[model samples]
Target: MRDTTADGAADTTADETADRAGLRGDCENCFGLCCVALPFARSADFAIDKPAGKACPNLGEDHRCGIHARLRQKGFTGCTVYDCFGAGQKVSQLTFGGRDRRTASREDARRMTDVFPVVRQLHELLWYLTEALTLPAARPIHGDLGRALETTEALTRLDPDDLAALDVPAHRQNVNVLLLKTSELARAGIGGRKKERRGADLMGARLKGADLRGANLRGAYLIAADLTGADLRGADLIGADLRDTDLTDADLTDALFLTQPQLNAARGSTGTRLPESVTRPVHWTPRL
Candidate 1:
């Protein structure tokens, strides 16, 4: 049976469920823009070097990954970590009116490809702005967040030329200021002296059972670190490299700015705690 709240919305909080709607990629609606427009070099993440605006050899006619299930085994782990935040589909359907670059004119195709990255950047800002709206500590600036969200959303609907002409980095800098304030408000709610490891090089460090409450770990390199049973409540993990970081029994119930890609890159167990806004990765297993 389905559930509903008093306001007739879903029972789950917006961040837990509805927040992802129209924000997460719907590949079915997408024209495989990421595979077609983005260049990827041959590395641990890909099996071949492909130039931008060229369709990947593995992309099917229907815009699906030919090796979707076997991507990792075929040296395409990077694809698994990517989430367009729904920009691909928006570009494919709304912006191009369901036009497939495969069948479109060369110039139109090129324009679509060019606009995609711009819309993607705007959509990412929209994602963070939407998340900021959900935080109670950020209520003071909810008006600002709402306005930013609306403006960013409007940008995604612009014509291809307008999108390509957008100064995305400048806009991102403006958005970052608000996001930093949101992070501060959210972390301050934790209320305690905490570690400051922002931008620290902690690759392969052993941090088992370490106390990191309210820690500022933005952009920290935590790759291959053993963080078993670590207390990371209220930590700011924006852009943190969590690749192979063992999260067994680690507490991240209030971690700020922790994105899905970061969580996906990390190794965790069923014993690991997480914020309600995030979910356990399918690759995670029970602690043995």
Candidate 2:
């Protein structure tokens, strides 16, 4: 059974499990928008180069990945890590009223492609905003976060034309102000001199066993960095590029704003401790 609050209502403290249910990808309800709307290059992550608005050759007529079970083995690791945060279903159903791109007019299909990425960005903000409300330390700004969440949700319901014309980055900047404050309040409780490494280029750095507790690593480029055995509790990892970062035995018990896609993009071992919000990536090495 799912855990509940004292009154049997869904728990919103720390985990925000109920609030995040709709913020995750539900491909079954989607029309394969990610495979058709987004472009990807032929690299280690993808087996072939696909252009935007062009359906991936591997996408089936039923809107399912033909090679779903063997995506990694077939050199499509990027698809495994990508999550639309539930934007695909929202666009397929609510935004376009269950219209299938295969049957829709060419102009309508083009609009769907354009509107999808916009909603994806908004949904991602919803993910963070939902998380911010669950932090007890961020109670001071709960009212602001709540209002932002409501506004962002309303934006997602806009018509395709309106959604395409929406000033997303400007709104993101507004919402980010609150997230920064949330980070400050949440990290302040951790006992230590917090490190401020916002947007720092730390690519390929040797940081194994480092103490990153309460560190601000927002937008920091940690690509290919060795973070094995690091203590990252309470660290703000909002936009840290963790691609290829080694996380063997790392304790990220309370790491702030660490999303599943970021964890999936990195390398981890069975010993890596994670926060409650995300699960252990299936590709991580097992203990032998």
Candidate 3:
């Protein structure tokens, strides 16, 4: 049997599982978009220089990376960690239906590039929503997550021209409302004084600046949720899905089992601080 279980992201670690589900880079089916569409500077993360919208210098004519297998040794770990969340396959097979970008008209190519970001953003949201539904605690937000997920999915199915015209940021602004609601439900699961948050579906809640010190937050669905400025000192964070969850400005000085990537992803406000072993994630606004 295939286990016949609901091992969606909320229940399982969407980090590892989603990566293995053929969601990561499989360039054979792609046009090397990440290599070209994304910009890279000469740094420890990237060995050679590459500009946005230009093909990578190492990109092979056959739409492959010259050093595909040795990307890590060549300092492309960021490239390796990136997951299109199924967008690469969708764009390759459906959006353009395996049409080669090389033959595309210059204007069409630019339009295609424009739409790639839109689809990419939508797929990322899919990954999060799919992961959220796996939580037994998040059942309360199931209706909201389902509706928003469908909306996001519909956007992903748009054709190149339609996708190019999409205002993804504005759509994100609207979806963030539901995501924020989902976050509140999920974070509420982190056992608090009220006790109603216990076993709550908090897969991706935004608990920024919330007080959760000494709270029982075990087995919470915390994958990728933002916890900026949240007080979590001595909070029971064991078994919580912390993958990619942002803790920026959050105080976790004595938090238990708050893993590296999870702790690293967090953005701490003035009130939010962490233990010495943990480091801040790459993304965050520390102006506060």
Give Cα-based local distance difference scores for all models.
Answer: 0.84, 0.91, 0.63
Please give the TM-score that candidate 2 achieves against the real structure: 0.94
Candidate 3 — what's its lDDT? 0.63
Better of 1 and 2 by TM-score: 2
Model 1, 9-120: lDDT tens per residue?
2322454456558878899999999998888999887889999999999999888999999988999888888878889999999989999997888898999879888888
- Report the C-alpha lDDT of model 3 over 6-29, residue by residue, as the tens digit: 432222333435433543345668
| Runs with alpha carbons beyond 4 Å of true place in candidate 2 | 1-15
Candidate with the greatest lDDT versus the true structure: 2
Q: For candidate 2, lDDT tens digit of each residue in 1-288?
A: 123444433234544677788889999999999999999999999989999999999999999999999999999999999999999999999999999898888989999999999999999999998888788798777777877888899999999999999999999999999999999999999997889999999999999999999999999999999999999999999999999999999999989999999999999999999988899999999755
